[model samples]
Target: MQAFEAFMDDLERVIRSAGDSGRGVLVGGDFNTRSPTWDPAVSNRRGELLERWAASCGVSLHNDGCTATCVRAQGSSVVDLTWSTPSLTPTVQQWRVLTERETLSDHLYITYEIRGPRRVKSGDGGGHARWNWRKFNAECFRESLDTCLAWGPTGEDQTTLAGLAAWVERTMTQACDAAAPRARTKSSNQEPRRLTRDRRAASGPHHDIEAEYRASKRRLRDSIKAAKAKAWEDLVGSVESNPWGIPYKLVLGRLRTASRGLTENLDSETLGRLLTALFPRGEGSVPVSQEDRSWNEG
Candidate 1:
C-alpha cells in the first residue's frame, strides 16, 4: 500500500541519518512481511521490496533462519525482523527471539546486545583450570576418591566439623585433578564452538559400528577445517576489497577479545563461604504449622 511505502521511506531516512552521523543503527519490529530469507515459508512482494530497501540503505538483516517470530491460532511465521547497519552488525551478538517472554501479542520478544570491548579482570592473566568433561575418566576418579575416603579422620581434622569438611573437600579436589583433563588456552584459529561440539558428538559412542563413527568424525573434522579456511579467505578478500569496512571492524573485535583473556575460577572454599553467607542458617526461626494454611482452603 502507499501508506506502508511512506512509512518504510521514513524509516530509511532515520536509518540513513544515524549512519551518516557515525552512530550505530538498530531497527527492529514487526515488518508484516514474509520472506524465505528469514523463514522457511514462501516469499511475498512486500518482503522483496523490504529486502531491496535494506540493501540500498546499507543495512544487514540480523534475523537467524527458520525461527517463528509470530504465532497465531492458524500457524506461525517469521514476520518480525531485526535490521542493523553494517557498522553495527558485527557487534550484534545473540540475535534471537525470546519465546518464553509473555508479550501478550502474536509477535515474540527479540533480544540482542551490542557488545563493546571487554575489560580484563585482575588475576585473570594467569589462566585458571576448567575440567575437560569429554576426556574425564570416571572409573579413575571413583577409585581415587574411595582411596582418600578410606584414610579418614587423620590428625586433628577429625576434632572439628570445619576441619573435617575442609579435609573432605581437599580429597575430592585431588581426585578430580588426577582423573580429569584440563582445557587448554583456545587459539584464535580454532574452529567455531558449535562445529567442534558437533564433531565431538559424532566421535562419541552412539554409532552401531566403530568404523561408522570414525568415518563421521573424519568427515565432520574435514568439513569444519574447510569451512574455517574458506571463511578466513573470504574475510581476507573483503579486507583487500574495502580497507575500511565491516571486515576491518570484525577484525578489531576479534583482536579485543583475544587480548581480554579467560575468566578466573573461584576456589571451592571461597564458593562455599559465599553460598553460606547468601543463605545463612536460621537458628532461632520458628516453623509455621500446617493449620495456618487458610489461603489454600479458599
Candidate 2:
C-alpha cells in the first residue's frame, strides 16, 4: 500500500508536467485497483485513493459506470480504467469495452478517441496565417529590412546580450510587418458568385472557423475521404495511360501543412542566426556576430 501511494504521487506529477504545454493529457493502464467512478464488481482501498487523486487533479473519469473492463471465471471487475484531463475529455468521441479478445488476462480492451492538437487554417478568426511564402517579394523584403536595420541598437543598448536580442527582434518584426503584412481571412463580406460557384463551394467547405475546435474533425474527415478518392482515380488513370509509370505516386501528392506563419521553434544558436539574417550590420554599424556569417550574407 505504501508503494502504491508513492506511485499515485508520481502519477500526479507526471500528469501536471504533460499538461504544462497547455495541451490535453491522457493517462491510462490496467490499474490493478478499483474505484466507485469506474469499478463495478467490487470496492477496495486503492481504488478509493485513485478516485480522490483524480478528483483533486480535476481529471474526468471516462468509464460509462456499467461498462466492465475485466472478466474472470469467478467474477469480472472494471479494473482497466481511463482518465483524461478536461482539455482532452470532450474530444473523446467514443468509448468502448471490447468483449471478444484472444488474451489470457481478464482485462477487456478499452478504446477511446484521444485527439491531438487541432491546427486551424490561416484566416480562421485568429492566427496570422495568410503568409504567402510562395509569392514572397525578396527585393521588397530586403529594402524593408535595410530601412529598419539602419536604425541599429545604440552603444548603450548594446551593453547586454538580452538588450541586443530585444532590439533585433523589434527590428525584424517591424520590417516584416511593414513590408509583407499578413492577409486577413474574411468570413462572408465578399461579393457573391454565381450559383455554380456556390455549388462548388458546397462540395468543399463554407465555414472558416468552428465553434468547438477540439471535437470538430468534420474538416479532417472530408479531406481524407477526398484525397483517397483522388488517389484511386489517379492510379486508375495511370494504369490506363502507361501501366508502367505510377502517376499516383508523382502527381497525386498534397502539400505539407504550413506553420503558424512565425519563427517560433528556435534554439539559442538558431535564434542568433535568425537575428543576424534580419540585421547584418554595414561597415559603419556594430558587428552582429562572427559565427553567424552565413546568416549575415546578402
Candidate 3:
C-alpha cells in the first residue's frame, strides 16, 4: 500500500538517524507483509519493496521460520520478524521462535540470546624506571650536595637532606662490590594499592558473593513471578483453575534459592545445570522443583 510504503520510509529515516547518533538499531514487529524474495511461496509486493528498502539501509531481516503451514492451519504467519543494523548483529548470538501453545496468540513468540562485550584488564603499560645513584658520578654528587646546601633550612631542606643521604648510601654500596653491575629494582611507589587490586579481602569474599548471589536470586525470582503472571493471564483467557500457578511460583522460588546457594559456593557447573534443568525445552515438561529428589541428588 502507498500508506505502508510512506510509513516504512519514515521508519528507515528514523533508524538511520539513530545509527548516526551511535545507538544500535533493532526493529521488530508484525509488518503484515511477506514476499517471495524472502520466502518463495509467500507473496506480497509491499514486503518485497520494504525488504529492498531495508537492505539499502544496511539492515538485515531475521526470520524465525514460523508459518501458517507449520502451525497446522492455525492462521499463524511468519510475518512477525526483526531487523537490525550491522553493529547490533554481533550482539544477537541466537534468535528463535518459542512455542505457540502457551499463549492465545496464533503466531509463535520469539526469544533472543544477546551477549555482552568482554572486559579488558586495566593498568598494563610501561611506567617510569626506579631511581638509582649509579647514574650519578662523584662530580654529579658534589653538584647535588651544593644544590641541597643552597636551600634554606626548612621542610624542603630536610627532604633534600634525606635524598642526599640515600644517594650517598647507594653509591657507597655500589663501590664496595668488585664486580657490582647496574641493576634496576621495581619501585615500591609504583605498586597499586592492595585494596584496589583485591577488593574482596577488605570486604570478605563470602559476604560479597553472598550479597551478589542474593541479588541474582531475587532477580530470577522476579522473572519467575513475571512468567507466572503470564500464565495467570493465559488461565484467565481459558477460564481454567489457578491451582497449578501457586506450585509454579513455589518451584521458581526454590530454584532461585538453590541457584543462589550454588553461586555463593562458586559451583558454576552446578548453577549452570540447575538453570538448564529449570528451563528445559520439551512437551509437557514442568520446571524442576526444589522438592524433587533428583534435584537434591544431583
Candidate 4:
C-alpha cells in the first residue's frame, strides 16, 4: 500500500509537469481501484484517493457507459481506467470497454480515440500569428516599420495597384511581427502580485523594512491601476479604430457566452413570451387607473 501510494504521487507529479509544459497526456491502465465515482457499485479507499489525485492533476476520467473492464470467474468489476489531461479530455472520443476482445487477462480492453490538434494553413494568418496587443512595443514597431519602408518598394511591386497594396500590407505585417510576438495562450493579468517578502513579517518585523514593504505595496497598487487604465484605453481605441477587429470579436463572444444562460433551450415562441411578459407593447403610455393612483398615494 505504501509503494502504491508513492507510485500515485510520482504519477501525479509527472502528469502535472507534462500539463504545465503544454503537452497532451493520455494515461490508460488497470488502476486496480473501485470507486463510485467511476464504478456505480463500489467505493473504496484506493478509488477515493485516485479520484482526488486525478482532480488535483487536472485529469478527467473518460470511462463512458460505466462498463466493467475486469472479469473473473468469481465476479466482474471495473478496474481499468482511462485518464487524460484537461486539453486532451475533449479529444478522447469513443471511450468504451471492449468486452468482446480477448485479452487473455482479467482486465478487458479500454479503447478510445484521441483527435489531434487541428492544423491551420500557414497563410491563413490564424490566431497562431495574431498580434499580441497587450505586449506591443510601439517604439520598436515604429523603428522596424521605418527601416522596412526605407528599403522602398521594388519597381515591379509598384507597377500595379494590387502590387502596391500587397507591398504595403506585407511591410506592415513584417513590422508587427517584429514588434509584437503572438501569444499562444491566454493569461489573466488580474491575479494578485506576490510580495517580495511574506506580508506577515513585512507588517511588523522591522521599522525600516516595514516602511520599505509599505512603499513596495503602494508601488504595486499604482502599477496595477496604471496597467488597468492603459488596457481600458487601448480597448476603447481599438474599438474606435477598427470596430470589426479582434476587440469587437472578443466582446461579442463574451456577450454571446453571457447571454447563453438567458437564451439556452428557449424556442422563438418562448422568447417572444418572455419578451412580452417583460415589455408589453402599447401604442403609448396609458392613463393610471383610480385604484393604482390610490395605491401610489397610500
All candidates' TM-scores?
A: 0.40, 0.42, 0.39, 0.41
| Alpha carbon deviation, residue 174, candidate 2 (Å) | 33
RMSD of each: 40.2, 33.8, 33.8, 30.9
Best by TM-score: 2
- Model 1: residues with Cα > 4 Å off, grouped in runs: 118-298
Candidate order by TM-score, highest to lowest?
2, 4, 1, 3
Decoy 4 TM-score against native? 0.41
Regions more than 4 Å wrong, model 3 = 37-40, 64-76, 124-298
At residue 141, candidate 4 shows an lDDT of 74
Scored against the true structure, residue 155 in model 1 reaches a CA lDDT of: 45
lDDT of 3 by residue, 1-298 (tens): 8899898889978876775454667888877777754445567787788777776676655664443312435344556767776545545646777764565555666778765333222332244222334654665334333322322122332357775565454333323221122334433334556546666565786878888999999999999999999997875655346645655566466435434453688678887888889878676685666775644455
Tens digits of lDDT, candidate 4, 1-298:
7888898999977875664454657898888899987788878889888887876665667786278888999888888888876445545668877789999988887777875434334544433446668989898678556644543454445577886786787667656665666544332222223443555546665867778888999999999999999998998889878998878788677535533575677889999999888888786546566865544455
Where is model 1 poorest over a 10-residue stretch in terms of lDDT? 116-125
Clashing pairs in 2: none
- lDDT scores in order: 0.71, 0.65, 0.58, 0.71
lDDT of 1 by residue, 60-87 (tens): 6778878889999999999888877644
How well does candidate 4 score on lDDT at residue 77?
Answer: 86
58-163 per-residue lDDT for model 2 (tens digits): 6766789887777889888887778776545545647888877656777778877754334336457565434445656777557545533433454434577886
Instruction: Give candidate 2's error at residue 172 in angstroms.
Output: 33
